[model samples]
Target: MVSRLGFLGVIARLFMWAFLLGLAVVVLYPLLWMVLNGFKTNAELFGNPFALPTGIDFGNYRDAWNRGVSGYLATSVLVTVTSTVATVFISAWAAYGLTRVDIPFNKVLTAVILGGLMLTPTVALVPLVRMFQSIGLYNSFWALLILYTAFRVPFTTFLIRAYMIDLPREVDEAAQIDGAGRWTAFWRIILPMCKPIITSTVLLHVLFAWNEYLFAMVFTNGSDVQTLPVGLTSLMSKHGTDFPVVFAGMVIAAVPVVFLFLFGQRYIVKGLADGVGK
Candidate 1:
């Protein structure tokens, strides 16, 4: 019986690992296929989608990059970088204030902020476009920047606030006694300690802002200001028959965010698991 139980345990563990591996492949296959096949010609792709390229035909990357991917990539990077930084800063400070301060109507204020999370962004598209246009920021980077920041703020605020609420109050008291004001206490004593979750939040938002397409498509019409995802699609239209070049453009847009997630995956897991239900 002992031998049989041990055998079953080993089998179970193997099965579990195999299952997870299968799931990873299922989820990752398309992205893997996209990147690898990106180097192959249409004829080559049709001949063997799964096989490695016969030779590295880097012209696809060269042509696409020279045409417009570089500009779009730069634009996307600019928008995502600015929006992510601003959002993180604003959300962190707002969360710290919400969780740490004992202001009147605090519950209501928090609820309103959190409520924004539940609201569908699609619902506000029309008014938002008009509003941005009225303010003369539409069809521009500032428009998309503001929209991205606003859309991401609520959830990030909630995430930071949830973690902040669970953080030990003793730290705050000690900071105060040591002559740190509210802002200083948060900056010096608390923010540093929340690095795991904050990093996770930044990564999450970076991915969001990077991949964001609808707003980018809607807000920025010109190739001069379009983001990667939007610009990649536009590249597809212009190079529809050139599957390799289109795929190459897609790969360029996707690689950074993919690597970013993979590298910071541990932080993401720890952030979500940390202080959860505490």
Candidate 2:
């Protein structure tokens, strides 16, 4: 009976490996195809989409970069980085307050913050556009930054608050007993202890603010404040026939996000698991 059970376990393991192998191939092939096709000319690409490029072509990348990708990249970096910082900072503080404080109407405030999660961006687009324009923020980098930060704060606050709520209350009490003020304890102790959740929140904000399209499209004009997604669309439209250059531009735009995920993936998984599971 034991031998039969072992045999079944081995078969299950093999089947699992095969399934994962196929899944990996399915996920990776499109990315590999895009990168490889980026090296092929229009003739080469249309002639044989599946075939490897005859030679590596740096010219496509160079041309793609020259054609305003550089500017778009800079703008995306600025908006993503700034917005992520602002979102995480503001959200972290709010989370700390709601979880740790005994303020009057704290429950009402918590409900209000969580209520933001129900809002879909499209519902508020017209009003947001009008408000930003009235405030002279339309078609500017600040428009995207403010919009991204505002939209992201509520969810981020919730995540951090979850993790914070699960944290040991003894730590905060001990800090207070030792003469540490709330601000000092938050900055010096609580924030450090909340590193895992903070990392998760930062990565989430980065991914959202980096790849977001609708706000990037609506909030900024294409000239100076356009982000990578909108920029990529414009690139495609302008060089509609230049598949190689467009592919190169896409690969460039994707590289940063891929690298970020690879580096922080461990922290992201751990933080989210701890924050959500407990």
Candidate 3:
């Protein structure tokens, strides 16, 4: 009976491994297929989507790069980096204020900030457009930066505040006894402790600002200010017959996000779990 149970356990383990392997394949196959087809010609892709390319075609990448991807990628990097920095900085302070500082109507303020999460972005689109246009910010980089930072602050602040609330009050008290003011304590003590969640927020912001299409399309008109998502769609529209080039462009745009997730996936999981759970 013991031998039979052991045999059953082995079979279960084998089945689990197979299930996980199949899941991995299902998740990875589309990305792999895109990368592979990026190296093929239109004829090759159309003739056989599943087969390997006849040769490594570098032309698609070069053309894709030339056709606005270079400019779009640059703009995307600028917008993403600037917005991520602003969002983290502002949200961190807001979180600190909410969690650490003693102020009147604090709970009301927290609720107000979190209430932003319930607001539909589309509901504000027309008002935002008018506001930006009136302020001379429409079709500008600042417009994207402001919108991204504003929309992201609520969620980012919530995450950081959650993490901050879990920290021991003794640390702040000890810092105060050691002649550390609020800013000093926060910068030297609290902020460092919140690094994991902060990193996760940065990653999330980067991913959103990089791939976001609606705001990018609506806010920016000229080629110089358009991000990768908007620019890539334009590329697709212009070169509809050339699937390989579009695929190559997609691969380029996706490379950074993929690498980021691969490297900091642990922080992402931990931050969300701990921040939300607490």
Backbone clashes in model 1: 0
Considering every candidate listed, which one attains the maximal TM-score? Answer: 2
Per-model TM-score on C-alpha atoms: 0.93, 0.96, 0.95
Q: Which runs of model 1 end up more than 4 angstroms from their true locations?
A: 47-51, 238-240
User: Per-residue lDDT for 275 in model 3?
Assistant: 78
Model 3 Cα lDDT, one tens digit per residue, 1-278: 99999999999999999999999999999999999999999899999999999998789999999998999999999999999999999999999999999999999999999998998788999999999999999999999999999999999999999999999999999999999999999899999999889988999998899989989999899999999999988776643668899999999999999999899889888888877777
lDDT scores of the candidates, listed in order: 0.88, 0.92, 0.93
Please tell me which predicted candidate would have the highest lDDT against the true structure.
3
Cα lDDT of candidate 2 equals 0.92
Residue-pair clashes per prediction, in order, are 0, 0, 0
Tens-digit lDDT string for candidate 1 (1-278): 99999999999999999999999999899988887787898899888888988887788999889989999999988998999999999999999989888899999999999899988878999999889889888889899889899988999998888888888899988988889998899888889988877998999999999998889888888888899988887765643467788889988888898889889999988887774534
Candidate 3 global TM-score: 0.95
List the RMSD of every prediction in angstroms: 1.8, 1.3, 1.6
